[model samples]
Target chain A: MSLGEFDLIARHFTRPARRSPLGVGDDCALIAPAPGMQLAVSSDMLVEGRHFLSTVAPERLGHKALAVNLSDLAACGAKPLAYTLALALPRADDTFLAGLARGLHALADRHDLDLVGGDTTAGPLNLCLTIFGEVPTGAALLRSGARPGDELWVSHPLGEDEPGWLGDARLALEVFRGTPGLRVPGEAFDHLRLAMECPEPRVALGLALRGVASSAIDVSDGLLGDLQHVLRRSGPDGRPLGVVLDADALPRSPLMRAQTAALQHECLLAGGDDYELLFTAAPADHGAVRAAGQRSATGVRCIGRITAESGTTVHDRHGHRVATPWASFDHFRS
Target chain B: MSLGEFDLIARHFTRPARRSPLGVGDDCALIAPAPGMQLAVSSDMLVEGRHFLSTVAPERLGHKALAVNLSDLAACGAKPLAYTLALALPRADDTFLAGLARGLHALADRHDLDLVGGDTTAGPLNLCLTIFGEVPTGAALLRSGARPGDELWVSHPLGEDEPGWLGDARLALEVFRGTPGLRVPGEAFDHLRLAMECPEPRVALGLALRGVASSAIDVSDGLLGDLQHVLRRSGPDGRPLGVVLDADALPRSPLMRAQTAALQHECLLAGGDDYELLFTAAPADHGAVRAAGQRSATGVRCIGRITAESGTTVHDRHGHRVATPWASFDHFRS
Candidate 1:
């Protein structure tokens, strides 16, 4: 049977909120942050075709829609608390909503994040989630604290570090797009697809890095694009500093390592949607950073350092600069 | 110059948040509710062609998007605090965004509701807003507390009580669609248009009704449909109470009164987008309701009473039941 808006909400979204004072009814949901804690809130919208292909499954879409927003909280070193989802649908299909709700709830339950409230309406397919988290007052990791000599790190290795896990969702996209001269062995495709379809947000690592990381941002747009936001805002009164990225240090799967330099450079630097935590820490906190990575259960890789110079540079192992112009995803160029 | 997502945010949305610990630019915004206060949260989504018409002004769309969400907070008697906007655009156009941002900011500033944090992306046109508010513990008005002797009230009279302020946005839609035999005189068309475009959320009255109202709701869907939600959920252990709505008691504008009974019934009973506050209070609290209306600078009309019987019914002056079946707007029926 088809579901109307209210019925769909009741069936799919009306769940008990463990943390909130009230959930999923009346005019507004009620919540109270623990005293001395600040509410960390962020919102993200995912549109079909633009953010995901229609061919992608709905459950994965649900996971990803929330994942991207949670990634923001992760970038800020906040503990997941609660969220509100506002979804626009073209029609009320029960099966689609079931899968979508299941996918959303699984991740939310894993993090102990309560689904406090949201609205569902009829329109084109769109999912927007606003996640709420908590951090101690004045202790949140920000994009404005990076300084010269700060060590840049990523929560997870960008490429395949182990046989079972290959973080090549970007490459998988290229392959799906029929890019020539690309090959992946069996089951590796599944891993890559999963990485692309459902990104695991680095919330634990973020919580661990609360006091260790100086500045941070999620890699949603290309690494360079998001990193530039840190670089732009961290400047002393709008004066930007350069960053040096170690080409050899960039985590790449063995397969990616064998690709031509141009393709490898493209995937390694500008490939967006990795959803990894790219953060910076003082050089003195390297040990603490490593410990944070240990607790987070993710590899923390130091791929570069902040510099006092202008513009971003990629250096070879020999320390010679590679001449790859900066390229990051832009939502609108047309 | 066209604004990139960041540039657009910087130029338009980058305002200092007086109430929040942090505002736009961070991965997440940090808000600390006052001591003894609980956070009230709601989310709403407006897709192009669904919530609005394409020819509608961008500014109006911006205002309405946030207004509708704020109305939810008002319904719960929560004080508006902050909101996050997630916008998807086909391309980066400055004029459209400028008007949109102006409209959004104007309303945000009026309520001292900070624009906390949001995400802007490239996609089809879609806007989602998640609003945050605050209410003292145990003081929020809900939809389940009305008693059999309580009187039903609306913050504003529906029909023309005063010249130049007929809220007929839904009717304006009919006018815009060139519905035959409907003529709105002079600038009444513009007035109706504004009523539709810029809804006044009854936050003041909502705050005033915090302790006075037994139960409350915002009139978004037609009066009867939304009221049924109250009546259905307000019942003891979810048992419903019947409502006797005096048809003559419904507030109607002079123009609406001139329409045929069917059309008047359609607009008065089931017309959507009025955004007025509908509440029930103890019979003795009628004076308190009037005072709240006075403080809110809006009219308060008592149109009905709660009864021991089940289900809602429209009655004529002689106490004869009117057979107009309950109807309201539904997004999807197919």
Candidate 2:
């Protein structure tokens, strides 16, 4: 059925949390941070063809748009408060927009974030989700605080599912689409589908590491590339960090281990869109981090340590130099 | 020459901003407000065909995108501080991006705002500008405070250049191409061009009216239509407001008067994108408002007054009912 903008908003965006004192349907949303908190704001843009494949589902696209930005706030140890979504969609199709908004609303509700003010207009699919979070002043983490002697840790092992790991193409498709090619249960397939389509923002893990972590950033442009950014942005007092990934320390699901195995390390190092936290902290905080990880049930791995030299080096299990990290998806690539 | 997104960002988006604590290269911008001030944040989106013609000057489109969002902060009586622009363009042409950046930079410099952080992605042309401003808590004006018996005022002449309005195909083409048809002296054309391309943000006027105005909103949609929003958002204890427009009391320019003879009165009531403040104040503040207007050298006229009524009514010069207002340009209209 045809849908107008307001109808889509009503159907998919109507939520009780939106009754926030400063919520959707206003010229500008009014916000008041709790006393002693500083507001952290971040914006991200997802463009059709560039940021996502056209074959991807619209709901997944919406979820990823907000997920990435929320991940940014999570990196700063901030709690998500509200977000403004500027959507430029190609057509006024009810089915497509509703699915997209449903994904966004579900994510917002999961995080307890109120959808605030934003704008919608006609264009090729482009979503800019601007999110605001609140962190106590002087406590928000930054990428500039990595100390020369600090240990560099990743929230989870990098490269979970390599291209070569997922079994035969047809079998994998059957598993992904909930059909029983190998007799995988429907509930298991559903769980896998949820894992592939929607990712929970690492809010609890981020907040838990707040005072202990010295520097942090979410791994969006793959582990190696994003670590390069953290290294590059380290302040004058901080030092460049070399991340040494123990090939055997990498984490993986049973399904991820079953597929093709050639060049699996290279693929995991180069592939992007893994929104895990990569952070640096003092050696003393390691005990606290390990204890907290036990309580939270979230993965925490120490991959390397900060260095005085200004470069990134990823060593193999045998401690040999590996291929340099390639650039992640660049929209203006020729 | 083809450009990669990283190079585009380094070349065009990495300019040092005097006001930003941490600038464009960071994950999130850090801006500390002047002590004790609350931040005002607003966002607006401009789609290629919806907001302007594709042939419209890229520079003007950039300026208008940021200017329109700044107007929202002005409506709330906040001082412009910084902005993040998320642009989705079809291609990464250096010339187009540079011109757009220059237009945005020029206006931002005039207002002393920093172009902080944003995302750039490839898609159909769409520009989303999210701006931030600061006002002391409890001092920011809102759209919900209008009361019965308050006087309605607007910041500029009721009718802008009707014939030369941006939508007129001939005028828009001439302005874009720098053709001399319907030309005035260079300085006058500069003013006209500024009006057409980058209208100034009314931050100062908005700030001055902080305590005086009961309610305010920037006139982006036509005057009557936007005013209806202010009325509809009236707070629970606020008296019902009735606005009566005295066609004679509207602020007018010499050119506007000459053009009014040909362009009907409806143009005055319905023409959009004035980017001027339309606000209400208690009748007791009228004299003070007149004095404030005189000192600032800007138009602030008493166009109407609020009354204890449920709906609004407009009058002709001879007190006849005006036809109902039409909807502003709908982006989804085919």
Candidate 1 segments exceeding 4 Å error? A1-5, A157-167, A326-334, B1-6, B157-167, B326-334
lDDT (10s digit) by residue, model 2, range A25-142: 5566766677777777888888866676577677877787888889888888888888888877677778787778877877888888888778777777778888888788788888
Q: What is the lDDT of residue A77 in candidate 2?
A: 87
For model 1, the DockQ equals: 0.59
Best by DockQ: 1
Weakest ten-residue segment in model 2 chain B by summed lDDT: B162-171
- Please give the lDDT score for candidate 2: 0.68
User: Which candidate's TM-score is highest?
Assistant: 1
TM-score of chain A of 1: 0.93
lDDT of 1 by residue, A1-334 (tens): 1335567767877887898888877778888889888889999998888788888888898889889888899999999999998888888888898889999999999999999887778777889999999899888999889999999997665335442122366787887798887766656676667767888888999999998999999887767777888887788867777799997787777767767777777777777788889999999999999999888788888999999876788888999887666564233221
Clash pairs, model 2 backbone: A164-A260, A165-A259, B242-B307
Instruction: Itemize residue pairs with steric clashes in candidate 1.
Output: B159-B251, B159-B252, B159-B253, B160-B252, B160-B253
